[model samples]
Target: MKDDDTRIKFDSEEELIDYYCSKPHPKAFTPSIVIVMLLCSLVGGIIGMELIVKFGLSTNSSIIGALIAVIVGMLPMKFARKFRNIHTQNLVETAISCATFGAGNVLMVCVSIIWVFNKPEMCTGILIGGVIAFVVDITMMYWLFDTPLMGADEAWPIGIATAETILAAAEMGKKAKLLIGGIAGGIIGTWLGLPMDIIGVCGLGNIFALTAFCIGLIMNGYWPTWFGYSLGDYYVPQGVMVGAGMVGLIQAIILIVRKYKGRSKTETPKEELKTADSTFIEPEESELTVEQENELLGEKDEKTGHIYTRTTKQMTQTFVRGIILYIIGAVIMALIGGIAAEMSEGMLVVWVIYAMAAALISEILVGISAMHSGYFPAMATVIIFLVFGIFIGFPPHALAFLAGYTACTGPAFADMGYDLKAGWILRGRGRHVKFELEGRRQQYYAELFGAAVAVVLVFIFYRSYFLAGRIPPVASVYKATIDAGVNGTVLRQILLFAIVGAVLQLISGLKRQIGILFAAGLLITNPIAGVAGLIFLTFRYFIEKKFGDEGRKNLNVVSAGLIAGAALFSFCTNTFKLVSTNSKKG
Candidate 1:
């Protein structure tokens, strides 16, 4: 509506260039963002580590965590127009990097699976594997992801969503108010879930941690029967999952009814028809064609759908440099791995090399998948890596490490690439960091630093929780499964579904999140939640039709808050568990 609004509504990359180039952005990473990032990083690490340890799931909808971090991080710059979008972009970058920020997911999954090998404790050997992953992942992120991100056309859906959220945060509109409300709601929700016994009275049933509450509700006479059938032995998850879905469905149906019911009052006859005219929601793909974007990049993509790619010579150099850095990093890792192993069995060197080789192959496969489809079969890749490890005749410790570490490190490169992809689109002023890294962007350092912080904090928590006698049974289950490989688990069937999921993504060009839901629907005994999501989104389409961006932003804010609140509670509960148990032991 305003001159600034006109500029901000970028229709193409040229518009982006005009808007960004018009501004002489003075500051890089503003101080307010930095301070908030530190807090976010700490919280993210704690929560992220705790999730894998306790629940084996991180924030599936990453936007929730990103929004939570932004709210908690006090992203004051995003609200102030004086600060460039690039600065805000950097803030989002740090927030996201710090938030899930660790290879912790891999470590938790790996260690938990093979806890049998270590028996009473987690293998220190795997810590070395984590170290190897952390270093190699970082190296790839710093040296290689810039190129990958530059070329890919995948939606990078979460990254784009975060960027859009950041954009919304900057707007002095209802969007900002909704985001503020979401933050407040999330905080309140988290407070309500605080421990009554331990933290004194706020402890209550949580929406996310529904297992105990779900069963308790059933066992405590909430429902003894359903439709003339006895439910006493029907399993509580069935009811809980059903209740969760119904709750979602009720909200959606109400919203849809309200929208169409009210629409008649606001719409003129002509306007109603105009609104009903055919509308195509843009695919979450490039706004510019490859040819058009080339005009902006000063480099044409000889290959279709890829942009800003390196020449063959440049690609070769990047490869050589990446490998050289990897080899050096591997040496440091081998030493740490040997230490973690507490013996020179030579598996450390072998596993590191194995990880590198697997990661390289995965980087191409998964990276391409993420770049073009926003769907990388991370679990499938890990399965393959584990199979490779099985062939290598790795001991339980090394086997678990190889599979999990490969899974973690390769996808990390993809994650960084997506973050950078968003950054590239937003156009960060690539500030020189050091003489040795003269051309590097400050955000790259920020990402690298985040990587280091996340690894340290998560590993510390991982060790601390283990010391406090938290043996994540899920990981132990994985370990048991790994021991037998195909003979041990139902993984072959799951992998089949996962591969089908990948193919669906490839063929339909659906987002990875959808594929994930599809996979879960196939494998899990419970799929009521997915059904609820589908119902909610179906309702959401009508809401968007009625209210557009304002409606969506509002929905995202409330949803993000609800989801993030649950995550906060989970983290705090886990952290308290470790602290209290450790104190008792002391």
Candidate 2:
């Protein structure tokens, strides 16, 4: 082997720092990122709770509500001309939004527990738990604040600061201090929230959103300390109220701090400031080459006489196409959900059908976006959820929630595509995006790998003198619902009809709506589901026209973020459960 010194090279300190700053790392600023994610979980929890209480929704509705809130929150940024200009600032904002969503979800869980138990004191316990969680999260964030990984970028500081504010608010016992902390947390949260929002809305599936929610749940004392003491068993209504109150306190403090800090910060040098205003500086003329400018504007090189500019009209056309696809996809999704709900006797089958449909929809959208603009995939996914939710007897608010959540996935998937495209655009290493795609393809296989490894490990442990029989299969909400007998036959029939319709449409070259109608006829036995389908269809018709050109551009990032956040949240939650279970047993 070559000597170890052979691989070593020296560089100037400045050069090394510049190099380090330019590169992204898996673990860099991870703690800050985790904190920001926790905050997002809190927000999600809170939104989930509010939906349940205000709208009298279920878990499904709460999820949908959070999804809707995320989409609504993302809209302003989507339309703003300056949104993309400040990438770092956007990153910070998105992080904050994610944190808020997470916080909301936690609050929702607490409230739900309270409602279930019908105990007033449970609220107090929840409040204490929330405070404790906030303190732990914030303290950990602060402790890791000065690490080089957290200091290398503008986004990191904002994320860290937001977490810090949340900690401060939770720890502050005085009413005034608590008020101040809440205000500060909100402002900072808002500031840091945008990036995550963007990611959640525009990305196809969010890995972060779910992960953050799960982590926050654990940190906030939602995860059961004992296997037999599951979260569902121990959660009380009072605990939820107290948690909400604590959250409110933190939000107030954050807002107050922001208000006071705003005055003094205005006097600082413009260059030194790290607000959204300062971060999104316009790109200089030098940054764009003649070729790049032509590419961006769809202009052509004079000598080559090739037109490179993609007109606003062309972009609009692409947007319209995406919307159309989305509508069609939605119809298909609704039909599937309805059929599954109707046909299967087993609840597990229903969930499996739903997951399969979602996975298929996601994959199809991804493929379609690859062939066109990135927005189509996410739009398609959202439309699918909305159409199905309404058509299959979901409540109006539930439909709205589904629409929002589904819509969010569009952006998440689009982002994955965009990231791939960015690699193409920037001539970066080809492996990053390619690897990502491959990873997605092999995800199921990876689970199998993990299972196999786990089995082997268990066998080894048993043989090595540890007292062990076979590990029991892990129980989950899905399993419980399955046991409850949620049927999927109706949903399956609907999906089959949809497939038939699509096939017919392809063969006869008929309008796509014909396929939707066919699927609807076969699957939608419930009036509620039918109403949802009609509502979404009507909305799609108007909005499709209204969006014209703007929606096309806006849909890409926003939808990507939504999807990414949802997926992230789900994945994280599952991972947490796995970790907790495994850790406990070990």
Candidate 3:
């Protein structure tokens, strides 16, 4: 093998950076990753549905699924000598969104329709509502985030932090290696069909959601295509899991026999650690100080030394197009409702006007909120929807459409704004989020694919979960709120706050004032992240006190490991539970 250790090696860090950053990897956001993402999403949807039905919990599903997806999606990069950091981020983004949408949106919403309103018959209405929400949200994202807010580099603190984390992990430091170990553990668990019940014994719930899915399979006494693209569907031999129990049993016995015959072996700890250190991956340094590179493509204001991302005319054009789309979408919803959903034109007009107002105003607030807090103000959005619904008299289909539209759109805008800002942070471009327009176009393409797939998955899951009789209490409550009788007083109060908030935001733009107050207030509202931040800071402080500045620096590397560890724990536990349940059933 020509002495593998001496075959090739970089002499210095600068040479290493040049080698990796010279060209991008080809594995990002391709069909291969897309398939992996879809499979994860299917599993996530099933797990989320399982939790909701069994324990009325779904909040942690998105985060857990996203983390796992990140690990699996990045596994290929472990072997790629030319892998780029941002490409790994893209794979994570694509896979995580699928998992999130599958469980968080589709199954949960379906459960709400059936359980909350006792209206499983309103399936069509649900789809309509989701479509309208998606459309409005996409429009709001384009108008509020990518254009005017591109100049607002610090708009999303969380995105910036996340991008930094990804880059830090890419350096293949101790933290990155730990994260990789966690990912390996997770893959092992999945392959072995492990169960996650151990965590549940300690009241740590939702760790074993998909783990028991095989039990669901066993009870079916059959497998159907309607179950979606399950892992076993294509991966299992004999074309199905129907009789795989016997095969597993035989393999288990063989493994037992092998274990008895084979002696245990272990590598020397010192040598393994030495090898690990020698193989550590390092990332290119693309981040630049302002003085290093100032020829960025964004325009600068000559008089004030300020950067203007886009012209006022461009922003104006974006707003006009968004408004036009909003109006047309509403008209289409109304027309569709008239034909099949029993929505009157007058009611539709009322809902559309209210949706337009709510979407426009809340888009700004949500975008601003995202910039300052590292979160989208989802609660505020629901309140906005409810308040607007009260003003519109809560007409059936119109109420559904408006509620879904406003509640969903603002948060979408917030995510887009944050992600764009994150991209800028990672790519280190002052004027643009990406150097290549193709990357931007790819984002749009991936977004459309994800969105379209989400709607379809939602539709499929709506049927599946509804048939399974899983009703979402929160979703039902929200749905009932939409279907409830209106109170005029509530409308007055909402309007009062809305008008005041709008005026404040508008005035702040001219004076550049609200960013500070809004940022401060936003941080205050996020007690969980705030407390979490304090804990991390305290931990870091103690490390510095004990070991000086070097320990503080190492914390950056360790953070990624912790994230991957958490994800690995979840994956192993979940898979363990599945294997246990499946074995028992078999």
Candidate 4:
């Protein structure tokens, strides 16, 4: 950790304080970074739309954005020197990462639902609603980050990969060569149609959870051939996800409650806990300053003197605020989509309330899976909520609105976690509290800008894609599920599977999240990915066994390299395809 390039070193306490207090941090929203961010956003948007439409998945573009920043910094120009700052590079990566998810997972999915249902007239309402949901989702993540729940220490594999990629590129040593080699291998493997990203995750993610995920994938992919029953056809995956998601949410609440409830005993004095400022209450005779009080209230890293900025209380309030905001956004979408006109007042109320709840739950489920394994089942989670909406007997148009609005929440939420995790690492793991917070705020602004860009890109280009009959694979599934509706047999299957999923999640507890990862795998039904990931995991285990912690550290760099390489290849090839296809159409 001491040799890690992401850390800041100073000669003495005076130097450290001067570095934190006096240095002018790189501005995220400056004109130069903004220009680079916009360019990266365009590239990210194109890659996202192409990959999602063609293959039904979107890779994190953080590495691509960071690589672009690094490339720009290497140019021989006076102005280019400023781009060398790691903070500036982090902001650029944050922007493109948001744009990628915002375009593909949020806006495009929403628009496609309306188009698939031949309700193009409602596309405007869905887009606006999606945009609003996206903003609120990112805002909530911003507030929730660094809390006890989704702390900076969470795996957040994609973020770690991006951060390592930047660090390696800047340092340019043996680690850099390893990263470059891994990237090249990733590119070559992906070109051969391999799941390089899954392999990358296999090396970095929780082994137990990923093993469960691989088992689920194998079961989902093979059971149809061996037993002649499609898990998806029986709604088995959906049921499992529903059960696991419910338990996962409860587990989160329990953790939050237990943390706060036991705070008086473990954290603060009983008298301090009762004060207006809660844990910040200091002794009268001590006369400690506010900084000292804050340090007392938060967790301090002994080596770096870094105290966490977000409190448990603040996280809870932000979560509640997010719920309220989602409710408002749902109501706005329902009104704008004209769903209110077709439903009874009671049913309309139910629809709005359910949409809000569904969005929040979906985001949590997706966020947890992403934090653990970097695999977010956004579409499947949306479908799970859509199934519930069907049971509630909403009309087809309302279902479309509900599904689209629900889809908008999770991807951006999870992607925001990745960006912040990267920023947290680059900012020296929050060692300098004020500087870290400032960098985080800048990342948020950059995310907002990128999301706004994605909204515009989707708004402008979705019609062309729809006209060309290029819709996401999930859109058709959404329509089919809505049209077929649900039956008693389906309900029974879902309930049975739900129980199994719940038990698995409960047994796994929160940290491992085996159940969530298993559900994510089952939802996809890609046996090849499972097999490939298992192979990579085996390799990683051996490497660690032979070399110990050093091997693990080296593997982290290589895994990051693999992800970056695959992403770069995907971007270049996909961008070319998009351009050529659109040109031919024109």
Highest-scoring model, lDDT: 4
For model 2, the superposed segments whose C-alpha errors exceed 4 Å read 1-35, 42-499, 502-586
lDDT tens per residue, model 3, 551-582? 64454334433333344565456656656765
Ten-residue stretch with the least lDDT total in model 2 = 145-154
Clashing residue pairs, candidate 1? Answer: 112-475, 112-476, 113-475, 113-479, 114-479, 196-201, 196-203
Q: Which residue runs of candidate 3 sit more than 4 Å off their true CA positions? A: 1-21, 24-31, 44-89, 106-121, 135-146, 150-152, 155-158, 174-297, 301-312, 337-344, 360-364, 416-422, 429-436, 480-586
- What is the C-alpha local distance difference test score of candidate 2? 0.29
Q: Clash number for model 4?
A: 0
Which rank order by TM-score, best down to worst?
A: 4, 3, 1, 2
Candidate 4 RMSD to the real structure: 5.2
Please provide, for model 1 over 1-586, each residue's C-alpha lDDT reduced to its tens digit, 9 standing for 90 to 100. 2255223444433344345534543232557556545665666666666666655555422444345544543434434443335444444455455346363455555555445566434455555555566556655555544332234234443344344445444453555565455545555655674211111101111111222222222332323333554332332222222222223323323533543465444223322322433211121235445432222221222343233222223444555665565555444544544433643557666766776666555554455444433334455455556654665666665565555556556556656665655454344222111111211245565555566667667556665677765655556545654776543233333343344444433432222223322321222322233333334445556776899887764665454444334444555566677577658969
Report the C-alpha lDDT of model 4 over 99-146, residue by residue, as the tens digit.
998998788888798889888888888888888889999998898887
Candidate 1: which stretches are off by over 4 Å?
A: 1-33, 60-86, 92-96, 107-116, 119-125, 139-152, 173-306, 309-353, 363-380, 428-440, 472-474, 485-586
Those runs of model 4 whose alpha carbons end farther than 4 Å from true positions after fitting are: 1-22, 268-296, 299-308, 583-586
Q: Give lDDT per model, in order.
A: 0.45, 0.29, 0.43, 0.82
Q: What is the lDDT of candidate 4?
A: 0.82
Sorting all predicted structures by lDDT, with the top scorer first, yields 4, 1, 3, 2
* Model 3's TM-score against the true structure: 0.60
Every model: Cα RMSD to truth: 13.7, 22.6, 19.6, 5.2
